[model samples]
Target: MNSIGNIKPFLQKVIRSGVGRWRFFAATLGLLVALVIILLSLQLYLNFNQLLHGKANESETAEFLVISKEVTAENQSKKNESYFLPEEIALLGKQPFADRVGEISSTNFIVTISSFSNAFPFYTDAYFESVPDEFIDIKTEDWSWKQGQVNIPVIIPSFFLELYNTGMAMSQENLPRLSLEALQAIPLRVNIKHSGGTAEFVAHVAGTTDRLNSVLVPEAFMQYANKAYGYQESKPPTRLVLKTLDAADPALQSFLVANSYTTNSDKTKLNKARIIVNWIAGVVGIIGLIMLLFGMLVFTLFIQLTIAASRMDIVLLQTLGASPRQLSGYLMGMFMPVYGAMVMIALLVLSVLQYGIHQLLLQKQLLVSPWLSVYTLAAAALWLLLIWFVNKRTITNYLKAG
Candidate 1:
């Protein structure tokens, strides 16, 4: 070990004397550029994912979309054509983009809501819709109901309040604007009219949701009321609430268009942006991989050139009792540090860019980590290992041949 240690510096000096400075510098620069580009592509992908799927960016309403058949002139008069058949719902559920599919049940009976307080007097004919409890964004204890319940809980769309405040309240002299808290405090008189008679139930706003744009009621209450007061037989669902993994998936948009289904455009507007980003990232990654191959090839040529130039010196050293393993180890020790340094420099540059991007995106209300992603770090380590393997193999083979 001591003899080998003593010979390392001499072997390193002999090996490096034959290396062309210009070629080594160019090879190092190319390798650094390749690593940076590869890491940059990976970081871009992760940052986009963070913006879309991070906990800080996640919305309870983002995963749910209320979809319905498009009301075209041809299908408007045909009630059956507007409804989703059981097979259609099953097929939608089986789709890769849809995590789960739920039917949006609507009341079959006449319904009306009026303010109980004369001071805030307003009356309107309304309809009630219900979806499964899991799909509802608003969670409240009052959302459940049983038979003979005197009071019914209701959930309204947040935009409904906005529309009333901006449109109706501005137009009417007697109507006053209501805040969400005030709206929840007001009690409503719900009148369920059937062919037999009208039944009254006191209803109160339990919550408001940005997800579903409908007057929502407990599914249990909707089922019971539709049975007890329904003038017509229950029909298939005309609307569906879908739970999806990605609201902006392009395949989801394609499927909707193919089946004449329509959903909220605002929720899916990012589909094009996502596709564009993916294409850009893919192109960058491919370019980086090509450059990396060229870089590795150049590095291998540099090594081969140095070994060929030092062939006479290496033969003399081996004849003077130095082992091929010792020379190979010394050559590796010289080159591996440079490779490690290049990787570190690439990571540092990426971290700075990521932090800058994180701050920039924060201004636009997008959230991403300032540090590098685990996948990026893993990729760096993997590439470093590959470089080491390639360098080691080249040194061992050249030393044996010499």
Candidate 2:
């Protein structure tokens, strides 16, 4: 108890080191705060960025191919045109390049569509197709159709609309060039002629996809719609949607060439903005790490300066029977409050910033977690431990050298 009582004087002296040398204290505090903010903020950004990108699947090697047999004069003369049999799909599954194979759910059933407005007077036979949900690049939440759902959601090729705008609509006085958004809003009445009766309902454009060049419906809806309205076929699909792990996989091209199967001309379109965001995060992270390292150096220097200023007192204390262990502990305690304050303040500020950013994302219809992720919290703890370890080591080493 008497030893503890005697140690208070040394503790007071160490704490008083920051009183006159306010510059060091303030600089250390500010630099550490900057370090923590930059480090944590950039880390948080990266975590959320990855989560968001994955949620959208904006670009993580999802390549879809609309593969159909190469039309040939000899094959065209035969009764059996071409179709992807179950065995062919199994063969594709065995290939090293293809990740998945989905039969393109296309209607052998007949379909005729007409505009609800007689002013448009548009009527034509349109083929409906649906690739698996994995193969479509469009958002799927708005792309479904049920018995009572608002309208049958359909995805059509972008070029099909471009053709109508350039060739069909330009020649006709009644038709207007439709944008994707406008086309999605407008409804088309589909009439399915079956068994001397026609069932009519409205179809809405869900979205357009660059992956496939044909009209698309949800696979579930295709089964229902066809069963209700068209003749059943025993034959397999002539068109298939191939899901490949890598767009640039050499085996994919070799197989396609070998089988004489063709796909859409567009290969892959990675989101340039996502790529730019990732690069920016990497650069910011590097800068933050440098600043953090500099902050640690400044803090270490602060400890050495304090020990130098109190060199005379330390010598007198040791001469009077105080040990280096007591001095190290006292110095570490002096810096402890600073570390604590920095952590609390940094976390508070980071929480507010993350909340604001998350709310902004919410407003944009992109949902992400508002709280700091486990990765950020774990990183913060590791950083704090590093600071504590370095500060303690500086005090112990300085005492030993003295």
Please give the range of 10 consecutive residues that has the lowest summed lDDT in model 2.
Answer: 265-274
> Taking the tens digit of each residue's C-alpha lDDT, what string does model 1 give over 247-366?
888899999999999997466878888889989999999999999989988887777777888889888988887787778777777778889999999999999999999999889877
Q: Per-model C-alpha lDDT, please?
A: 0.88, 0.74
Q: How close is candidate 1 to the true structure, as a TM-score?
A: 0.89
Alpha carbon deviation, residue 355, candidate 1 (Å): 2.5
Among the numbered candidates, top lDDT falls to 1
Total clashes in model 1, counting residue pairs 3 or more apart in sequence or in different chains: 0
TM agreement with the true structure for every prediction: 0.89, 0.54
